[model samples]
Target: MNFEYSFEKISCKDVENFEKIRNVTLPYDYKQFLLLNNGGKPIKRRFQSKDGKITSSLMMYFPISESVEISLDEKYKIYSIGKIVPSNFLPIGIDPADSLICLSVSGNDIGKVYFCDMDYFEEDNELKKEFISLISNSFTEFTGSLYIPE
Candidate 1:
């Protein structure tokens, strides 16, 4: 697959700092990927939705730095997932539809990736209202799921 957008490689120190600030351990596979490429857009971004009929596409991979900014941005207060996202649900990417591709850094679902639908929060839906769905068991699994579109 090709990448249309990407950030510079990050150092282990950057990852360490991020973990310390977020107070969560970064998933091994994701950490390695950050070291290789801080962030980038995936070429073949389509993935089957939970319903099986619809497909989703990732727009851009948010860099670790950008993720931090987004989390702290006051403009996104309404979109905050609060505890629903788990304190460690670090956003790694975004979908054109405003959904977030997040990594569960802490909790029973640690290391798992999820599609966090921002629209749910915008509508003030209940936390348990199925606003989030599992994307992959791990970062590696998620990457493996990606493919070049024919």
Candidate 2:
């Protein structure tokens, strides 16, 4: 695993403010992580792709502000709720191929992380419905899945 962290840890106040502005409650496990370190690259970066055939690694994990920024920026173009990705799914990280790793914030799947294929969604309109795939049940589980490759 090769962890490359870049931001300082955020304070509880920052988290609270972020929550208020975003209007979404972050999962407990991920909230704890944000307090420890705002955002960066994870060490055990690889995960199963949405197709279940290939593997992928996280490109970057957005800080709270960055997450909000990207979510809003891409909302209409790529991640609009009930369009490409789900409404409550906020992008947390990206893959080498620019696919998104999202956290479900509002729906029944809240707290679960997902691997989303943006390319597939953009390329095939009919496939948009199947763009997202589950990665882990929680942030802790996602971190625990990281491993150093030989």
* CA RMSD per model (angstroms): 3.4, 3.6
Over all chains combined, what TM-score does candidate 1 have?
Answer: 0.80
- lDDT, model 2, position 120: 77
> How would you encode candidate 2's per-residue C-alpha lDDT over 27-82 as one tens digit per residue?
98888887786667777777774346656788778775544554333442355334
For model 2, what is the alpha-carbon lDDT of residue 26? Answer: 85
* Model 1 lDDT, residue 125, Cα: 42
Which candidate leads in lDDT?
2
Report the C-alpha displacement of residue 80, candidate 2, in angstroms.
Answer: 5.1
Backbone clash total for model 2 is: 1
lDDT of 2 at 101: 84
lDDT of 2: 0.70
What ranges in model 1 sit over 4 Å off?
A: 49-54, 66-84, 123-129
